[model samples]
Target: MTLSSSLLNAFAPTGTLRASINLGNPVLARRTDSAEPGGVSVDLARELASRLGVPVSFTSFERAAESVAAVTNEDADIGFFAIDPLRGAGIAFSAAYVLIEGCYLVRDASPVTRNEDVDREGNRIMVGTGSAYDLFLTREIKKAQIVRTALSEKVVDAFLRENIEVAAGVRQQLEADAARTSGLRLLDGRFMVIQQAMGMPKARGDEAAQYLREFVEDVKRSGFVADALARYGIEGASVAPATPV
Candidate 1:
């Protein structure tokens, strides 16, 4: 019923799954002294913890770099974010819990309608630095000026100020930004598809990791996963039923 001494010493449970995580500042995670619950990332984390019968603790940082570092340093047991192979080399992952499409946020009056248009002439795209979208743009996209912003929120802000012609990020983040601000539109076209999962330390010997994976798989097996996305008003995220054990 309790974690062994070795396990306890490695990752002291805060009664539930102790996680040091952050949603991307503006969209996925937000921190405020206000009464609001901030974002869906925190909401999902708590839900997963409650189901797992563990208390969830968070070390909310302002950036992914900080969150990743915190997890690596054992300040947090897990990080809820997109999985990167480079980072995955050092972190373990539950099965991908969600898949999201990256999209374009263009000015309402812009002539740009597709990826082809950006390369033809004067156009600028704003992206979050170190984000998967940015990595893809730098690799597959050419001919446009790519400006790297600090985060999804910053990219949204820059586009709002007309500093960049377009912003690229997850649809949820962009649409959420648009919901709060005017004159921004999420273009109908998708730039990329991204898969998000829970992250833990790289050590494979940890029994808790298996529990984490099983817990995630169970969440998918149950109706809970899709319901959480629905509660967040996320339309595209759907979990397929689990296969036979």
Candidate 2:
């Protein structure tokens, strides 16, 4: 793909494309044995840079909020994040490239057996601070009080340590936690499906956003997303469907 000069400048004002990588979502990114960032998001960033004819540099964050901040503040040129209206204020997102489930986890002995029972009064739910599930549950869960931990990876620990009634997070993370800890299990179904997408600062203009949207659709259509997921051994997250014309 040949990028316009204006689009290239919009994405790489510093002469290199700076991508904000969030390690909070294991399905999107993770630290390899070499202690460097690697995963589907990293792959996409590199691909974008390759097309733009610029070098790619990553600014890694342990939390989604931090990664979003980097892009929103223009400290980084682009980022991957869950599509949320609150974040749309500063970031213009592409159509989602991945769909991940948001699920509830509770002690096996707990009375909550279904997704519908989790919002009842007196049930305190633990969530990662500023994560997609946290933002989602804050709006949808009217009765249950939300408890927050520093990172998504720590939600289960906080839930166990603090004795919260429910823990909310990505399905894969919660499933792994359930396996690692005894007497815990996931609810039968997901409460929500998180739409993960690429985003850049809204200041970059509508043309830039449109280009990104097209780039996302191209990658999804070309099997780049599915191939990346399989290569990374990510399960339970599907490549997002193509956007309607």
Candidate 3:
């Protein structure tokens, strides 16, 4: 795609595309052994910068909310996030480029055996503050009380620390935590599917947003997203399907 000068400026006013890299979502981004940002989202950011003929700079955040804040406040030009209406108020999101499962984890001996048993009156669920699942469960879980930790990576630890009945987050994260900690197991099915997408500040306008949307669609169709997932050995996440014409 030939980007207009205006669109290019919209994406990289500082001559570099400042991409907000959220290390919170392991499926989308993570810290490499060198401690630099590296993952599918990082790859996408580099590709977008290359297509725009601009250098890319990464602004790392340990939490999704911080990443969203950077983009919404225009501190960064672009970010990867879960598609949620609350976040959409300040940002224009493309159709999802990846899909991740949101699951619940509990002690093996706990009574919460099924996904349906999580919202009981007495159950308290742990989640990452300001995460996609946090927003989702906040809206959907009417009965259970939500207890939040500072970050998604801390959800399992806090769940154990606070003695919460359930812990909720990305399926892979929960699975990893379960494997590391004895007596914990994920529920059989998922509660929600997180739509991971690229977004820019809403003030960037429709043309800029349309360009990003098309860029995401093109990458997904070309297998760039799938290849990146494989290259990183990321599992339990799938490339989002093409948007309908």
Candidate 4:
């Protein structure tokens, strides 16, 4: 796709596109065995840069919030983020390119067998600080207490150490955590599906955002997203349908 010169300039004011890559979200990205960053988000960023005819540089962050902050502050030209109203204040989002399941984990002996059973009054849920799960649970969980940890990868450890009743995170992470640590079971179904999208600073203007939206739809329809997921051996994440702007 040939992006207009104006749109190209809007998305990459620094000449090279600096894409903020969040390594903390295993569902979106992770460091491979050789310590190279690889995942759906990485592929998308490269593809975006390719379309713009610009060189891409990656700014790696350990958490999603950090990635969002980079884009918001214009420290990075773009980032992959879970679309949320709170974050929308500074970032302009494309239609979501991926949907990842969010679920709960609890001790096998715990009485919570179903997804709905988690929001009850005495249950204390541990979530990654500033994650989509933490944001969602903060709004939806009226009765349950929320305990936040520094990283999504540490939610399981926090839960175990604090003896929290439930741990909330990406299903893929929670499933792996449940497997390595005995006696922890995932809730029957997912509580939420996080919408992962590409975003640039809102100051970049609407035209750039529109170009990004189109880029995302083309990537999904062109099979790049599915191919990327399969290439990474990722499971439980589905390509999101294009949403009209």
Q: Over the full model, what C-alpha lDDT does candidate 3 score relative to the true structure? A: 0.94
Give per-residue CA lDDT, model 2, range 1-245, as digits (tens).
56788998999999999999999999899998875599999999999888889999998999999999999999999999999999999999999999999999999899999999989989999999999999999999898899999999989999999999999999999999999999999998899999999999999999888888998999999999999999999999999999962
- In the range 1-245, model 4's lDDT, one tens digit per residue, is 56688887898887999999888799889887754588889889999888889999888888888888999999999999888999999999888999999999999899999988988999999998889888888999988899999888889999999999999999999999998999999988899999999999999898988888888999999999999999989999999986776
* TM-scores of the candidates in the order shown: 0.79, 0.98, 0.98, 0.96
Error of 3 at 233 (Å): 0.8
Error of 1 at 33 (Å): 5.5
Clashes in predicted model 4? 0
TM-score computed on alpha carbons, candidate 2: 0.98
133 Cα displacement, candidate 4 (Å): 1.0
Q: Residue by residue across 1-245, what tens digits does model 3's lDDT show? A: 57788998899999999999999898888897775689999999999999999999999999999999999999999999999999999999999999999999999899889999999999999999999999999999989999999999889999999899999999999999999999999999899999999999999888889999999999999999999999999989999999952
Considering TM-score, which of the candidate structures 2 and 4 is the better prediction for this target?
A: 2
Q: What stretches of model 1 exceed 4 Å from their correct place?
A: 1-10, 13-16, 25-40, 47-54, 119-122, 179-183, 204-206, 240-245
Candidate 1 on 1-245: residue-level lDDT in tens?
A: 55465654344445555666555644456676864335556766787666555667667765566677777766677777676665576778777767778888887788877755765447778887767677677787767888876765577887666668888888878888888887778878687777667777766345767766776777777766777777656676556445332
Error in Å for residue 39 of model 2: 0.5
